[model samples]
Target: MPRPVYLVDFSVYKPPDEMKMNYNQAYTLSRQWKECVDDNHEFISKVFQRSGISPTESYLPPWVNPATCKEPKYDMDSAKKEAEMVMGGAVADLLEKTGTRPDEIDILVTNCSIYCPTPSLCSLLVNKFKFRPETQTYHLGGMGCGNGVMALSLLRDLLQARPNVKALFVPAEIVTYCFYPGLQKDYMVANAIFRMGGAAILLSNQARYYSTAKYELLHNVRAHTGQDDGAYTCMGWGPDKKGVNGVYLRKDVPVQAAKALEVCLRRLAPSIITWGQYAEAARNLFERRVLGWQVPEYIPDFTKCIDHFALHAGGYAVLKGLMAAMRLPTEKMLPSFATLRDYGNTSCSTTWYVLGYMETCQGIGRGETVMQIGMGGGMKAGINVWRALREVKNVHPAWRHVAHAPVTEADLPRPINDPEAAAAAVPAGDIAAAVKASFGADFKATTAVAAH
Candidate 1:
């Protein structure tokens, strides 16, 4: 049998308040896009009004500051700066929480979908934290939002292969290079939704840390439908007709996502659900196949097996579709919706934010199971099953502004264009100070680097 792996601790990065992008600021910046016509303006306005992204939720890279540069200064240097700001802040917090040093980590895995620079992010972390030269490192790129759980799946295998070791996993995305300067509605969708965020996680299989660990890795399952041409082309990053680069979102994305998820759930069901549920499902299948009954296909009661559900906060439409398909109640989806409302779509780190919301706001009890589901580009889907080993109720910095209660429909306010009204709605907090303290001088230096 494989050695058991436990989650030592995790930290979610909170962007500084100065980086906050309200609806008015985002729209104002949109107007600066070269060749943006009246139709483009109408589409952007409609998406902002209905995309379920709140006014005070998203943050942009300092390079896109309207006050300084009219056109975005997207290049290798800007991308590197963003990687440092989000990843550095989260890793600093994780080290503080786990009380672990850089050299102690036996393995390091970092994932960023679009920005794969020379001196990979893994190398960047190694240099910043002074990790040992012998540290084993892996970097994943172009895998999209599903990479959060996908990285966990990779970590679990690495831990099982090498016993008595600790692993660090950081999943993030740099939106600096993904800004679309073109007029294609499909390509411009990324500009409207993608935001800046990330998370750092520590995992260990050593027996010494098991007692203090919050959860144990139960199951890791992944599915990919890239073999189908439709799925392969649903989402991609490339230059448009004008030779402008961006990540395009085809209208077929939702349909492809559903197909990818269906393929993943088929493999995940047998591992988590009980025998009784399986027997009932088989009986229903028999009726539909051999008994000539008009019964529908069986979908086992996942709630019976899982206590917490951390679905990727892709967008409002994605969340609603998944909730309806899984037959989950509004309460089960609050964490994901709340994350989307507060942070927009942070790509690979979105599910971690959802899980943080659950741990900080709605405490997960000991022995409860958390099923994290991730779906993203490349038409990929992944699931990570975790069983809580301790009651986790501590307040996380990522959700510092949110009240420690279940988020409801009323909690998600509509997007507003008035800067003063939006700022007033945001609760006064020391989040900016907290983030600054985490990176200290490093944050300042990175911001300065991005400003040029």
Candidate 2:
């Protein structure tokens, strides 16, 4: 039997108010993207109009001057400060909650997609916290937003092999380094949405923790579409026409993400869905493949298997695409939306903020289940299933200051172009028709596959 893994506690870093940037503030900052190019300014303004982020979101590596929107300092010292600001606060809070000493941590894993220095983030934490010299450290780079679940899956495997050991999982991303001052519209959007945030999660296999632990890790499934040309290039780092490096996001990212998520859900349904639902899906597959019948797609009602959903707060477009593909309700996806509105898509740590929101705002009951889905730049999708081990009474640090206010779709600010509403406007059967009309008949099959 596999050893049970439990999440005893977690923490999400909250940046200072000085680092906050609303839509208008971000628009003002976009003027610096190109000091001499008028077209670049217009393009960035257009992207900002379509981005569904609000005016009250926070950022990291504080700007030199908020009034004039001065460019942020990007030297190594600023990088260290960014790390300490997020990682330090998160690790300190998590350790305090779990009452686990630094020396007791058998394993330490840290991930930062674009900011991997010579002395890795794992090393910096170990030294700062004074962990035992024998403590094992692993660093993950270039894995993008999906790395949080990836790190959890790794820790799950490690704990299963080494009993009675505690592990620390840190997921962070520093947007200051990736900030682009170039003229590419694809790169400028990064400035509009990516923000500063990090999370620290404590996992252990000790039976002693099972009683007080908030959740038990049940299942983790990972799917990658990097082999496909469209998926691989959807989001990545590249140089623009002026040879300035930056992260480029293609316009078709949401569509590609929907396809990748569909592949992941197909693999995950059998493991967590009810046996009856699984059997029905298997029957549908058999009829389509063996019986040569044109069977409609089988979309498992995930709401039946999971009480809450912690979808990645990637952005408005990505969230809308996943919601459409899964046929999920707006309520089920509120946490993701709220996180984006408040925190501004903090990369790998975005899922944790969503999870925290679900716990404090949505209220998870004992024995309830949560499905965490993350999609990242690898054109990758990851799913982790966690079951509440007990009713949680303690408020998470991330939600401590947050008001006990309810959120709804009406409360969220609408983007200028509102792709989510546009996607929802088409009838279920006509989704393919709309895709064909938009992206030509050759691309119709791809959209059709994702819709069902």
Candidate 3:
């Protein structure tokens, strides 16, 4: 099938629970562990040794307070409970925001990596949202940080197949649930970095949404590395106290994964570079004397080519790596850095918030391109390109600027996604359980297998 033009519409929910930290307040605190502990044994230093994030006696910011390195303070039960509630709340809010009822949504894609509840689809959302019978739903698990794009890609494909069908793509990953007590460098990075985030995007292939200037998903590209165990590997979650599963993140993630991007991009988009460029590249490869020598020649004029860049807002180093790999200027990567420094990494939904921020405040120009990139465990990377068709307007409750914003850390919210752990916990042995209880098993398991 020719690439389908999929219109992207999104809803981001940073629950009230996540607003516990002051803006960059938590990161600021976590950044001071060197003084809080011995420089050689500081938490940041251990996890990011390669980055030279050693303890220093240098000045630190006021809000950059160290996380009480004590056992994770969150109650697994409570987090799941909250996720259960927030999951539905987010969907409801999405329905209300988009002015669409549950049954109206023809295709549903829900992702909450940390928690997959019993009667997964119907239990988590369908029943609560009052959906109609036979709503196609998919639950994505273990797709890690890059799964959001996977979900969107699936939705786009489905929408293209059934042109009038409306697809609701929701990425709800809550980090608070599985956080365990331990200063292990890798785990500490997960704790210090990942937080709560839930986003519900309404997607369609309808000509109307496109004519109105929504982000149209033009293409999707996926890259995987570390599969052979050199630098890339599968990332998983383990059951902790009370059976809450906390995820494992590799420390060698950033640099190791960077090398793999070239291979993945080429495989996914054999034509990402046109024949003319390919010929030039081929000449450079075979005949050193033939290719262009100008340094700026290979670096596309990102500013002129793309109107805005909503990078994953993954982290400082990751964003920097993307800039280098893409050979983009610093200005292009600012939105991502700003988002990470302020909100920390919201995992799956981070890139969407960046897009939303651009959509609301900065305003996307007509026919401009907005590049969205996401990367995470299993050392995955997802890049889905967007094109704006009209004037993008302001949408409130957006990601606030760290320097100029009035929204405080109080705005950061903890979003949850466990339906089984409600006041009445669903039994674990409910397998052979009805599809409702096994909501995400099919898709999540399948995605994991596909990645491997």
Ranking by lDDT: 1, 2, 3
Deviation from native of the Cα of residue 337 in model 1, angstroms: 0.3
User: What is the C-alpha lDDT profile of model 1 across 204-241, one tens digit per residue?
Assistant: 99998767999999988888889999889877888888
Cα lDDT of candidate 2 equals: 0.73
Weakest lDDT window of 10 consecutive positions for candidate 1 = 443-452
RMSD of 3: 13.1
| Segments of candidate 3 deviating more than 4 angstroms | 1-3, 23-76, 231-235, 239-245, 267-286, 289-304, 400-452
Lowest summed lDDT window (length 10), candidate 2: 443-452
Which residue window of length 10 is worst by lDDT in model 3?
A: 52-61
The TM-score, computed over Cα atoms with residue i paired to residue i, of candidate 2 is: 0.89
Best candidate per lDDT, number? Answer: 1
Clashing pairs in 1: none
Name model 2 segments beyond 4 Å from true: 29-37, 64-69, 282-293, 415-420, 425-452
Q: Model 2 residue 206 lDDT?
A: 89
Question: Which residue pairs in candidate 2 have backbone atoms (N, alpha carbon, C) closer than 3 angstroms, thus clashing?
Answer: 22-55, 23-55
TM-score of model number 3: 0.72
